[model samples]
Target: MIDDFLDGSLPAVEEAVRKAAAAEIMPRWRQLATHEIVEKSGPHDLVTVADRLAEAHLTVSLTALLPGSVVVGEESVHADPAVYAALRGDAPVWIVDPVDGTRQFVRGEPGFCTLVALAVRGEVLASWTFAPALDEMAVAVRGRGARLNGTAIRAGSPARGAVLKVAMSHPDYTTPEEKAALLCLDTEGVEARPCGSAGLEYLAVARGALDAVAFSWEYAWDHAAGLLLVEEAGGAHATLAGVPFRVTGANVLPFTAARDQATATRIRTLLTAP
Candidate 1:
């Protein structure tokens, strides 16, 4: 069924996956738990019941849809060293973060999302990021471009010497590059809202809300789906080194195509120049 669906031989199977994702997710969106959330990285890093449930739901349904495809979810494998081992094996893997913005979720913010991405041979093949709160899902394939809800999406603006909107992680834990980018880039427009997720930032850039986002940490499940969205949405993204995003384990400095990659290239060059 997986092969058939990938080969464009079964639309029903694809629809089944989509429906399963939504059905298994919506009801539990804002539901609370009786217990406190777990702290993965630190006090700011959060894990909730909704995260585990959504991931588990996706895993179970996708497993039935595509038998033999490996599944690595955020709630489970993040702490399991065995996951690293299994992921290094010779198999297609689905890297999912059922809830990408758990911090925001806990804060009753609707910017949280479900990230579903398929990586084959360590390369991202297809991605679907569902922002339940915004009723937006950015779906992208390698060659098919990207879309939100059923309409096509694209990125076509830049922020320079103007009002700029930027998103970042917690400043208390922000990386050096992220801080530098904020300081060095001067703009009249300041809509700097640092939420708990990179997925929403990427989607905003794709949909033309934010102008750029500089990540202080490495890329995770949150940004992979966003990377595809930005790339397919006609935006430009690269590491701090100015390298076009590939499978490298590097953090990203995402800028709009409206900047025509010049700003990104300049920033990357500035960051990497030593």
Candidate 2:
């Protein structure tokens, strides 16, 4: 299926994502009226008309490009949580987060992006992360490596013997144990701060801007594309339990992605340490 995707539908998928972003997302950036934005669960959790329209557009175009494929979009799942069940099904599934960082997007921030990943059962095979505001696009194929814009790039190595810089989940969103573990990064000679979008954090790790990212949530739409990007760029992501992350959303909390396996393991150890 991955081979088929790379050979036949990759371009179409990219086009669908770009089209949805340009048509529904970029146009509304920071231009949304008060009524167009609303809270999902709280003040921090947001949804916008752009997110809905983009997901709707991608769902139709993507499903058409791959006849039997199903879509598990963020907005769609918010409307019907059952839509996520497709990720566990036998068919190829398109996990879409039309506007990945809704809060950032609402604030006219550049960290928000459009995230799309193709997964079978529970494993992601290919992924795309498009930060329309930043005019950056990253693509990753299962074994073909990853690309930024159109050029191949490798994840940079961490500086030798320097304090690792990390972006961690905000304390407000983490459990008490998770928060304590996250603070351990500081004691371990790591610089830790709050992360914005999970997608952009992964991009930073892949590009070597930041040493690592520790995230508590495991939503497929948030982590799927970025996980592939990091892995293909010679980076690695794993749960604190020392296992690979699954897009099926059944992983332990506070997973870490870093420039390499060793850095990832080290960050994970710090975050999970007692």
Candidate 3:
């Protein structure tokens, strides 16, 4: 199954993501009525008809594409938290975040994206990030490297004595301590600010548009696709403990994904600095 997925099945998965976004996401982009959007946990935490319908669409299509494969979709897990356990299972699992930046989507912004990743036993093998509104698609296969709109790309090289441009998590979504740690990036020789859309942030790291991204949360649907993309693009992501970021939905907060391991270590050090 992995071989087939690498050889030809990937395009089908990519198409499924694109179709879901087109059918259930894009059409409702700026056209959603009041009733179609709802707050899941808070005003900032939103869910729309597009998010639910697209995850449903992806769940069916992706499972059909790989028989016996399980789906760990955001909405499904939200409904039944047990669905997320599939990431730890031996079966091939599809981790789907139908709309990664739902907040942006609800605001009729273009930063939203659909993220899907194929994983087995916590290892992501292939991933697709489709920013329909942005008309950008990023695909990565574990060993074959990554591509953005069909062109190969690599993460930016680490700065040599130059101020690093880092995107830290917004304070609104972080704990006080985490915010304080993130603020360390503001010290001399660094430019730091909050970032938009986890998916786009990772893509920026992969394409060399940004130096690195510091995230305070570790949700599989949010980071799985982006993690694979960055790694395949010759970047690295690690928890402050100095280990590879895991996708089993259980990880330390305040992780950094950088253009390279050296930069990642440096960012982690600065973030942990006293």
Ranking of models by lDDT: 3, 2, 1
Task: Give the poorly placed runs of model 3, Cα more than 4 Å off.
Answer: none
Superposition error at 153 for model 2 (Å): 1.3
**Which regions in candidate 2 have their CA more than 4 angstroms from the true location?**
none
TM-score between candidate 1 and the true structure: 0.82
Expressed as tens digits, the lDDT of each residue in 1-274 for candidate 3 is: 6887679887888889999999999999999999999888888778999999999999899999998899998889889998888889999999899999898998889998999999988999999999999899999999999999999999969658978888878977789878887888888978888888899999999999888999998879999999999999999998877788899856666899999888899899998874
The alpha-carbon deviation from the true structure for residue 69 of candidate 1, after best TM-score superposition, in angstroms, is 1.2
Tens-digit lDDT track of model 1 for 54-171: 7777777776666687777777677674674444456767778887888787777787778777766667777787777777767877677888887898776664565656665545
Estimated TM-score for each candidate: 0.82, 0.97, 0.97
Q: Per-residue error at 107 for model 3, in Å?
A: 1.6
Clashing residue pairs, candidate 1?
A: 163-189, 164-189
Model 3: how far residue 111 lies from native, Å: 1.2
lDDT per model vs. reference:
0.65, 0.89, 0.90
> What is the clash count for each candidate, in the order shown?
2, 0, 0
When 1 and 3 are scored with lDDT, the better candidate is 3
